[model samples]
Target chain A: DAGITQSPRHKVTETGTPVTLRCHQTENHRYMYWYRQDPGHGLRLIHYSYGVKDTDKGEVSDGYSVSRSKTEDFLLTLESATSSQTSVYFCAIRPQRPSRGTGELFFGEGSRLTVL
Target chain B: AQTVTQSQPEMSVQEAETVTLSCTYDTSESDYYLFWYKQPPSRQMILVIRQEAYKQQNATENRFSVNFQKAAKSFSLKISDSQLGDAAMYFCAYWSQGGSEKLVFGKGTKLTVNP
Candidate 1:
């Protein structure tokens, strides 16, 4: 329990629709990541933010975008949802302090999305 | 780039028995970290154990222990006295030392603890 929360624990949207999932953290960690879990692919990174307004694409960033306006919130938006985008999305945070070089990630419960 | 592999897709162990999950990773970096995570039906990703590649000594946490062979590039997790609560999907992950905060994870191994 790293004080991380994700909104819309479960969602179902039609294809070509817009969907956004929110992740909020109270720990004030400097690094946040968005990952999607599929059956065979495991968990693939979608996007991550190292600091406020500083975000980068991940392995599976197509059709997905992310924003980190402040230290506590990171939002993942699907420009136009597709059936292939249906999966469980997880939000993770890590302490960016140089002292913590281990790079351990504390993850939120998860948000399950269904694009039909 | 780093890649982790978990050969076993699923495994089972009788209650109180021991079970081991295998993991192998590919990385050119000499220094890095390895981890094991558990995701139950609840879908919460929980850290089960971790090992630093530089540490010769294996890492252990209560009933969970990791056999980390830096030379073999293998990190395996052994669970003792497996409990029903341990039934879940287990993942092997890797993170480079002193690099980006990104973590690469394996496909995962689903473990079942039978009563």
Candidate 2:
């Protein structure tokens, strides 16, 4: 538990509405990632940030966006929610240059979002 | 792009028994890393074991161990002396050596431990 926290542990929003999930870390890790967990998809990367103000798209980035203004916070937003966007969103962080190729990833509890 | 695959969707084991979960991946890069993550009902993802592709020796952590087959692109997790706490969804993940350090995970295999 690297002091990672995800806000709105559970949420329900109507379709076409915008939604944002926040991830906060206290470890000051340089890398942060956002992933959505679906029933059959496991965990699919939605977006990731390497440093402050640096962000990149992931495998399932089509309907999502992320921003990291500070090293401790990363936010994932859905411009317009969709039914398919309903899933458990997770935030992960890894210390800069993980040693020994272990590439350890610390994950938040998770945020469950539903779209109606 | 790297991909991880877990062939078994569900598995069961009895207490004090040994159980192995299979995982395979597709990667062109020779030097990379593999990991097994466990997510219990608590919904928190915990790292169980990790293996480096370059290392021929398998990695073990307590009751958990990994059988890393670099040539076959196979990484499997074996849990010995299984306990009820071992019942969880196990995920296989892959990460490249360089760049963003993003992880690609498999669908996961649910492990049920029967007392």
Candidate 3:
């Protein structure tokens, strides 16, 4: 238990609507990541934040946007939700600082979303 | 670019037996870290084991151990005396120390422990 949690453990929405998933952490970790898991794709990174306001894109970042205005919160927004975006989203965190931590990432329970 | 490949999409083992999940990666960088994560039906991803590229000896944790072959670019996970609780989707991930803190994961291997 790394004090990581994702809101709305499950959600269902119609296509073309907007959706946002929230990731909250209590560890005050420096790095927070958003990933999506599918049948063939295990866990593909969507976006990640390094600090309070610094974020970067990952391999499968399209159709997704992230913001980290605070260290404890990382948000992933689907501007316009689509059928393809219906998948389980996971939030993960790790201390990127060398002396402060190892390379291991603690993950949240994951949020399952369905779009019709 | 870095990529991880798990050749076996599915595997099964009898309870109290041993099982090995294969993982191979492609990376030009020398310094990196590899990890295995287990996700059961609960959908929670838990870290199973980790192996650093610079470590010569294999890494092990209780029943979970890894065979690291740096030159061959292979990292495999071995579970000894598997239990029914070990049934889950096992994922192998790669992360370069010098690169972004992001992890590249393979498709994963679904493990079934039969009684």
Query: What TM-scores result for chain A when each predicted structure is judged separately against the true chain A?
Result: 0.95, 0.94, 0.94
Q: In candidate 3, which residue ranges exceed 4 Å CA deviation?
A: A97-101
lDDT of 3 by residue, A1-116 (tens): 88998998999999999999999999898889999999988999999998988999998899999999988999999999999999999999986566533677889999999999
Query: Which candidate has the highest DockQ of all?
Result: 1
True contacts kept of 1: 0.76
Query: Candidate 2 lDDT, tens digit per residue, A1-116?
Result: 58999998999999999999999999888889999999878999999998999998888899898989998999999999999999999999887544624577889999999999
TM-score of 2: 0.96
Off by over 4 Å in 1: A97-101
Worst 10-residue lDDT window for candidate 3 chain A reads A95-104
DockQ of each model vs. true complex: 0.83, 0.82, 0.83
lDDT of 2 by residue, B1-115 (tens): 7889999999999999999999999998877889999999999998898888888999999999998988799999999999999999999999887754788899999999999
- Measured by TM-score, how close is model 1 to the native structure? 0.97
Model 3's number of clashes is 0
User: Candidates' TM-scores?
Assistant: 0.97, 0.96, 0.97
What fraction of native interface contacts is shared by candidate 2? 0.79
